[model samples]
Target chain A: MSFPKLWSFHGGLRLDGHKQESTRLPLRAARLPERLVFPLLRRDGRLAAPGAKPGDRVLKGQLIAGGDERLDPPIHASTSGRVRSIEELPLPHPSGLAGPCLVIEADGEDAAVEIEGLANYREHPPEELLRRVHQAGIVGLGGAAFPTAVKLAPAGRRIDTLIVNGAECEPYITCDDSLLRHRADEVLQGAELLRHILHAERCLLAIESDMPEALTTAERALREGGFDRIAVVPVPAIYPTGGEKQLIRVLTGREVPARGLPADVGVVCHNVGTVAAAYRAVVLGETLTSRIVTVTGRGVRQPQNLEVRLGTAIADLVAQCGGYTDEAERLILGGPLMGFALPSDELPIVKSAHCVLVAGRGELAGSRPAQPCIRCGACAEVCPAQLLPQQLYWYSRSDQLERVLDHRLFDCIECGCCDVVCPSHIPLVQYFRAAKGKAIAKQREREQADRARRRFEARQARKAEEARERAEAARRKKENLEKSAVPEIRQAIERARRKRAEKTDQHATSDTPGRS
Target chain B: MLALLAVCLLFALFGLLLSYASRRFKVEGDPLVDKIDAMLPQTQCGQCGYPGCRPYAVALARGEADINQCPPGGEDGVKNLAELLGVESKPLDTARGTEKPKAVAVIDEAACIGCTLCLQTCPVDAILGASKFMHTVIAAECTGCELCLAPCPVDCIRMAPVRETAATWRWPEPGAVRP
Candidate 1:
């Protein structure tokens, strides 16, 4: 398969992939551990409310925790398990924060649930298919983990192109590559299903040029499946070329507006894993209970991809990968460039986790004392978003949020490209990330203040109106009393005159005009 | 003598144009006051010796109030106010009160006497209760002004520090870099 033209993004790195280390072995299934910990909290801070109580027996694929379709992706029991307890446990984050999680002890039976699928999904409405996807708890497996159903349904827009992103450009993450090489047919079918749902004109299946096997396998699958609408295209293996915005630019040469989604450009991009998950959800009636994770690095004895169940501990995955090697020094999630270090290996995997990179000593860059930036412009030159990193760093450090905002700080994407190229060895992306948080918080505070101000004004207006009504009522009461008193005073005077006239008549009669 | 007469005539014409412009573009309200008010945190706690944020903003716009009088606004607030009013920023006036972390008025319902005093004092009407009935604070609307605290005869209302939950936990500013 060939493309008419290929485009390139502004700035990216050509780092050593180290992907072959994990792809050396075929994908294998991870054995279910004794205990599975499912953290209810998502990376975005949304909580999936627990649906099953402790001590309750649950079947595989049964919903254990529920979530809002748009915010939280529902969690299901990975295997038939008895609920141990739902309590707080350490989450998989850089901060090592504790959050509420569901602890399930697998019974080892792997009991099945009644599986159903829409054999004729084409006959159903798009909304129904979208509902099924949401029910399946599928999210973008490309690390963003945004709700796939919500992304697929772009309101008030027309989708002309759908990009099946197999471009796993991050170093040491070969989960997508393995999935494409093995299950390319399922992914293509999923792409066809997505096309029917989106009513897109054509679909572009983008794979990184480095993965010759994945590219070849996908091409064969497309040919065998007669997927005329889907084309297998190879994108250059750039560091962040897999980023939603950057990938869109590389394929279509259309820059997604800052803070805008690909759907805004008449295109929709989905990870190859997410598409395959969607296909499974619609065709096989399977919930997202497991995912393909690449457990590799110099730290582990064996480096390979494992189709692991959700809620499996990282330690278990490492143990399955032959445990830690003598040189094992650091445990990081995702790629070395973007992934954060986990404090311990006891953290459970979630739907979003694609890579578990355990780095050996000196395998990762050690922090050096940061020197003052000399305005070298190297960071700017390598910034994929083409932002002036030095200016942003200065403004962010000085708390000049207005200037940072004016420079379009939200567009930074925290890709760490600037951090990689900075001669000063400063953590520029960290600064940007911290500043972005502050900026968002400031925005929220302003919104809350504005709301309070409006409420206060409304209350003032209401109080004033109430006071005026009370005063008007009091004035009306006084006027009514005055008007009522006039009649009583007039009646008293009339009675007094009658009594005086009667007395006068009585006196005249007594003085001998008696009959008169 | 001819030049002096022309200068006097020109000044008179300029004055007439200024008067006309002022009358033709007469503004109903002081927009400066609104700008000053927008800079305020709008807690309506009256820590600035005004009835509310807008009154203090009005005073500030009229050059009658000091920029440091607001404690709820804190140092950051003072900076914002100073920038907006084009004045030098100063520390918050400790005479009014010290700046505290963001909090909300939480009513101890069991200890509440149901006097409804807080209901009347709340600037935003965040309290919901009737005479001789339990009053609960609508936490979302409560500005944590402490105005309600004083009005509670039972002393049941207290300011509880807002805890950072998963949703509200923000990334802390990065500290000094380590080698």
Candidate 2:
């Protein structure tokens, strides 16, 4: 059957889909690693305060860190283990700075944590379903681990549609594709639940047209499961089609306003993997313990997709996959478009990690020394957000922050489509990221200065008030002394004169030596 | 003669509208002084020989105080203030004090005699205590002016520099500090 007709986003690229090496093999189960270092910092770079201390025994799937899901998702132990230590460890970041992490040594038992699950989710109201999702530590697994519960809460906003994103647009990141292919029934089941929770009239699952096989599988599962409310739509295979705004635009022909969210425009979007996780969270009594991770690249000896447990060290997975080839050069954590290079293999795979990319010496063919821009408008042409990448590049490079701010610098999503087509090979996205950081830091400094100024003013006002009260008290005391007795003032004057004479007499004896 | 009278009447109406617009949009106070005060750190240290930053700002607005007098406001601070006031930036005065890191006073409660001497010396009244009890400085409101350090009878006060926490820490500025 023909998929639903699609509309086009402004600009994108059809980058070579380097997905074959991994998808050739059916999904595999990763071997258990001996030690799991759960980064105390959540995937959003927030501190995940530990719930267990060192030497404490933690069962598999037990809550190990994170306080509330409103700000960040809670982290769970991947296997039954003993807390080894909580200290600094190499993290999955380009900066090379270490992060706080909880080290747990597995006991090989794989015992499950004691928890309860819902028997029938439909019996519960929508608010209860939201709480369950929050407790299960569910997030948008697509790069941005935005807390899902925040989006589901209408908070006085009306929503009409729920979009399930199964595009898997980034090359070599096929976890969502595999999940849809194998677990279509579960994904749709989760989508139906999401539709109900959001109170949306229609639920649409958008997949990239290139992945026809997965789309057919998902649609057949939808029909077999009698989920008439949900339909599968295949959009063009464009890079960044899975971006929340771009996906919404491609499917519904609506643009999420700048500096706003999808719910503002009567819609909400979730990754298909996120939806499937929600389904399992409500029905199967499972936390987000494991997910399908793509381990592929020319540099890897055995490139395939595997269901790896969260908090598992990357080095162990590399060893289990027959180690890296001699030609391996750089190790990247996510898709090449938006991911950063991992400083070391000791960094654990985080929840937002969808791929472990190992590029051989020549794998990055076009990525070379950046050249000067040729005043070409290609970047602006391909920008899905329709931002002026060239103008921002010039303003940012010159450190003209105010000028760039006026030009709407934050609107660029850093999708790497412009970098792909630039004739001069300028890394436009890098410039934008640096400029954004500088801008934010400057804004913070100004705010602090303003706060200091207000406090100083308040302090001065308080001091003046105190001085006034003190002077009034002294005046009232003198008046009381005069009113009590008329001769009291004369007596006080005599006492003051005697005290002054004594001070002068002492000074004369000490300095003049009786000459006076 | 009638045409000339018509022209005079039109001129009167336009003049009234213009005057009303000017009066309605008249700005109050010296904006330059407020802007200059904003550039100052507002430490109220009295290091510049002014009672507070606001009086010093007034003097600057009146062209009486030099831009170089504020030592608490370091060279960058002076530069910012000068830029706002349309004057040439100069070095900070060495007599007051050198540019210092942000600091706060921490009282050694055990050593403190509860004499309340520091309470009177603090310009900001950041210290809180009864006459015979131990005093504690509110860290948030403290200006790090060092005025309270001199009057502590037992020398129980220490000027402690602020430490950076994980939240306060930032990725070093690109190019200035590589990685």
Candidate 3:
């Protein structure tokens, strides 16, 4: 296998890999919870509509929410159950807000409706295959949860490199690691399918060098699966290296354009789990109803990875992992660097619920007030996106949004690297996020005003042009009338002159006869 | 003496070019009015006691109207206009209308006379109906101008705040999220 010449990224962190606590145990499927809450929207604030309501019977793997032209992913019921109520439930977001969700009271039957899959996916057109992936509701399981089907190559767009991102770079997140280790063949099948659909020249599987087990597994699987194009390329252990653009740069030395996608550089990246889900959707006739989650932290009695049913109350899953040992004060949902603190464990797992870190009391909580910036350049040193976080913070705090935008505040991925290394304990990512939101809101407002102005100006211009046309037409009509009247007036003048001459001649002749 | 005359002639020629260029690119009306209009929430709601946002902007540009006359723009809108026009920000005019939440006109179908009065009065033409058929508000296009509210003889048209859905829900501030 010709592993593409390895490349390096600009800035990254050597984080403490706490993978051993979780990866020790083999992956297990958690027992189905009696009650589950399915938020209508995903954590990233995606818009989904609930198709099932209170007192509606739904089967496992049955579509219950979403499927809109907005290109949002559809959500399926994880188990056969009746929806008890559909209302606001606690969601796993940085902002602790409750959103509308579908609450299902399990019937405990765990029955599913028969799912159909295409036997020969190769025979079908790429669009048809992509449509099935869309119908199956597959999204990037790595984190963003952006619809995966939209990432498919557009017709005539040459997609040369398909990067299968198995690099579980974030600390304390071993779900992707475990997924690759257990189901490398399945992931390869999905990547191969993606390659076929995208017609990519090469497929690169990037895994962190720390994950020797997953790398060995992928290597063996690639050997056995007979995928001529795919190869396993292990990267150095780094925080935020798993980021889409960062991973692409690490593998191919190509930088994704700002405010653009990987496809802009003839590359497409998919999470290993997402590709696995696509494989199941296109081959075995399955839906993305469950995902592997790493339930690990210093506070938990046991740390293990569980293949959790979607909408399963996280507290129940914690109990299945032998419950909390200490008062797990900081309940973070994802890895430590970027994960948000959850108010409670009762919140159910959505598709993006990859990790549920239960930190001890005051672990994730901030205690110190923000000190003044000491002109320290520590934040700039650690930014993976190579942004000046300190400058962004100053502009953001002063509400100098124009300056903030000039500094490319949006490029800061909110990875919390600056927050970790800051001597002042400054939450730099939070400031950048707030600033980015404000900037985007300002942009949207400007766009709305521009639209309205365009409409108003167009209306005014059309009216003015119409008035000008009317005046021109009236002028032309008057000119035509004057032109036609000119000859008649001339004829009248000629007749008058001739009559006067005749009168003179007759008078002269009469007078001359008298004189003679 | 000849050289001096030549210099004078050169100055005159340059002055003519400058004058011609100035006339060729002359902008119409006050450019300040366009800037002020861009700041107004372009809802065209006429809540500013003028015909539309642009007309109100024109009045402001002429120093005939106060910047605070626009309620739809709210206080921030006034501040933006004030900052642009170099004036002090003032509270919105209550006589014209107070800054209320965004609302759409809802027609009570039972009480609707189907007079099409509301449809005619709507600035954005968000209300749809025939002369004798019941009209409904296309919620997406409704600017909540409330122009249609007064024209209804039967008082069937009611202005209601737009409802919040998951799609419209915004991320709450960190301090605002109740534990």
- Of the candidates shown, which would achieve the greatest TM-score relative to the real structure? 1
Residues A166-285, candidate 2: write the lDDT tens digits.
Answer: 988988788888888888998998988899888898899998888877889998998799888888998888998999999999988888999999999999999998999889888777
The number of the candidate with the highest DockQ is 1
Measured with DockQ on alpha carbons, how good is candidate 3? 0.17
Instruction: Predict model 2's lDDT versus the native.
Output: 0.83
**lDDT by residue (tens digit), candidate 1, A1-516:** 346888888889998999999999998899988899988876566677798999999988988997555766688999998999999898886667778999999999999687799878999999999988998899999898889998889998999999999999889999999999889999998999999999998999999999999999999899999988888998889989999888989899988988888999999999999999999999889999999999999999999999999999999999999999999999998888889888899999988899999999889773666889899999888888988999999999998999999999989887888888887888888888779889888888889899899989999999999999999999998667656758886677679889999999988879786565
Chain B TM-score of candidate 3 stands at 0.89
Better of 2 and 3 by DockQ: 2
**Model 1 alpha-carbon miss at residue A271, Å:** 0.5
- lDDT of each structure? 0.89, 0.83, 0.84
Q: What are the runs in model 2 whose C-alpha is more than 4 Å off?
A: A1-4, A42-46, A365-367, A481-516, B1-28, B41-56, B67-83, B88-177
Model 3 lDDT at residue A20: 96
What candidate 1 gets wrong by more than 4 Å, as runs, is A42-46, A67-69, A481-516, B1-28, B176-179
Count of clashing pairs, candidate 1: 0
Best by lDDT: 1
Residue A10, candidate 1: alpha-carbon lDDT: 82
Error of 1 at A173 (Å): 0.9
